[model samples]
Target: MNRKNFLSSLLTIGAAGPVLAAAATPNAVPSVSRNTAASSAALPTPLIIPPYLRPGDVIGITCPAGDITAKEILPATQLIESWGFRIKVGETVGKKDGVFGGTDDERAADFQQMLNDPELSAILCARGGYGAVHIIDRLDFSPLANRPKWIIGFSDVTVLLCHLHTNGNWASIHSKMCNSFPDDWAKAEAIQVECILSIRRALSGERMEYKVPPNVRNRNGRAEAALIGGNLKTIESLAGTRSDIDTAGKILFVEDTGEYLYSIDRMFWHLQRTGKLDRLAGLVVGGFKVKPDDPGEEFGQTVTDIVTARVKGYGYPVCFDFPVGHQKDNYALKYGIPHLLDVQEGAVTLTDTSVPAAATPSL
Candidate 1:
C-alpha cells in the first residue's frame, strides 16, 4: 500500500476496537499540567532539552518504518555532516522486511540501541511510511526519558514523539526527516529553506516565531500553551494507544495529506467526541493537501469550515494555512514546549516561549 493508505488502513482498524474506552483509561491519559505543576510531576521533566549537536557529536539515523535506500538518505546525511556533526547509520537503513525497513522486532532493536547510546546526540527517523505503530508498543522509552535526546520526524513518527512527550514529558521536533531533505540545498524553495533552518534552530535550542497570513475562518484572539499534534491519521491511530495526546489547555496543530473529506470529518468528530477538542488554548490548522471526496460523495465542507464549525463556540484563536505538513514550507515546531499564538486581523504570530531571546536566532 502507498504511505497514506497504509497509515489510514492501520489507523482505521485501531478505530474499530474499544478506542474511546482505551483512551479514557487513567494510565493512558496525558499529564496536562501548567509549567510549575508539570515540573512537579513524577513524569520525566516536561520540555527537557536534549543536548544540542556539536562538532564531532554523532547522530544516529534509523529506519523505524518504511524501507529506504542509503542513496535516499545520502543527501541529508551529507548536509548534516557538513554542519560538523557525525552520522551513525543504523542497520535498518537499507534492510527491507516487506513494506517496512525491517521487521517489528528488528526496527525496535535498532531504535532501542540508539535510545540507549550515550554517544548519539539525537536519533532521526529515516522516513515515515507506516511501521511505527507495530513497534511503538514494543519499544521502551525509559532510556530516552533519562537521556532526553532530540527525537525528530513527523507523520508516522508522531507515535514516537507523542510517546516521548506524553509519557516521558520530553521535547521533540515535528519536522522533516532524511527523506524530505533536498540533494542540493541551493535549489530548495523558500518554504524548504524555512523548514531546514527551523530544524537547525530547534536542535540548537533556538526559539522560533511565525508570521502567518490570516484566514477568514480564523478566530481572532491570542493564546499561550504547549504545542502538540501531528499527522491526523497517525493521531487517530493513537486514539486508544499510549501515544494518544491529551490536549487540555494546549495549542493543537494538525495537518494531513491524501485523505477523503469524509474521513477527515469523521476523524475530527472522533477527536471532539473523545474530548480531544475541548478546553484547548488555541488551534493551528496546517496544510490539508489533496483532500478529495470519494466517488459520487461529497463532504460539502472545507477543512476550515469543519474546524470552525467544531470550535465555533470556543473563543480560542484559530489560524489556517500555517506553513506546516507535507508541504515544503513545513516549519519545524517543538512538541511539548510552551508557545504563544497571537491571531489578529490580517495576520497571526506564533512564538516559541520556552527558549530565551539570545538562544533563538532568526531562521
Candidate 2:
C-alpha cells in the first residue's frame, strides 16, 4: 500500500473503533508483572550478560533447527575464524532426520553439550527453518545459567531467545545465521557483508546503534527500555507458554516472512488482546515479506494500517521498517539488553544503552 492510502486507512480505522473491537477475541490470560519477585519471573535482578568472545575463544556451531550440510556452513566458519575466534563444529551439523537437524534426542544432546562446554564462549545456530520448539522442553538450561554465553540466530531460533529470557534471564543475539554467510566474501554485496559482520561486532561486545530513514507513518517519540522481540508469528504461537516473552515496559520489535496481511493483523490482535501491546515502551516493525493476496480476497490493509489500529490508544513510539528480520539488512540485536529508541522526523535511532558510549564503534 502507498503512503497516502495507508495514512487514510489509519484515520478511517481510528474513527471506527467499534468495528475492530467487535472483531477482537477477549484476552484469555491474566496479565502478570514481568518484574514479579517470583524466582521464575521473566526479568530477574541483574540480567545475565553472557561473557563476550575474546581472541581464541571457541564458538560452537550447532544445528538446533533445520539440517545444514557441512559444506554449507564452511563460509560462516571461515568468516568467524578470521575474526580471531575458534570454531567447534557440533555433531548436529550435517546430521538430518526429515526436516530437523537430527532426531529430537540427538539435537537436544548436542545442544546440551555445547551449553556445558567450558571452552566455548558462544553458540551459533547453523540456520533457522523449524524444530527448536520440539527440543526446547527436552534440553536442560541450568548449565547455561551457571555459565552464560551468547545464543545466536533468528526465525525458529526465536524459541531459544525467548526461552532464555523468560526462564533464565540470560541475554542472547538475534541476527543472521550460517546459511546467510556469503560464499565469496570479496564479492559479496556491502550490505550482506555488513549484516554478517554485525554478528562479530555483537559477540565482541561493541555497543550497537542502528539508524534508518524516517517513515511518514512513524510515531514520533523516544524510549529507553530493554529491547525484546523476534519473529511475530513465533511470538504469538508462544503465548501462555514458558517461553512466552514479557513485553511490559520494554521495546518490542517484530518481523516475519511470507504471511498474508490478514494473518499479520490476527497476530497483532493476539498481541493486543493479551496485553502485550498495552504497556510497551515502544514498538518497531521490521522486514515483513508479505504474500500477495488471492483474487477477490485482498485484505486491503497495509502493515502500517494494521499496526496503527492495534496500538491506537497507546502512546508509545512506533517505527516501521527498522531493518531487522528475514532479510539481508537484518542487524544484530541483543535481546534482554536495555536500548534507547528515538523516532524523529528525519531518522530513527536504536542505541544500545547497556554499554558505555565510548565502547560503541562508529557505524
* Cα distance off (Å), candidate 2, residue 213: 0.5
Question: Which candidate wins on TM-score?
Answer: 2
Q: Write the per-residue lDDT of candidate 1 for residues 4-91, one digit (tens) a residue.
A: 1111111111212211111121112243434331222323233445555567878899999999999999988998888788899999
Off by over 4 Å in 1: 1-45
Query: Residues 122-209, candidate 2, lDDT per residue (tens digit)?
Result: 9999999999998887766655533556899999999989987776456799999999998988889899889888888989889899
Clashing pairs in 2: none
* Winning model by lDDT: 2
Q: Over 4 Å off in model 2, which ranges?
A: 1-42
Task: Go through the candidates in order and give each one's C-alpha lDDT.
Answer: 0.76, 0.81
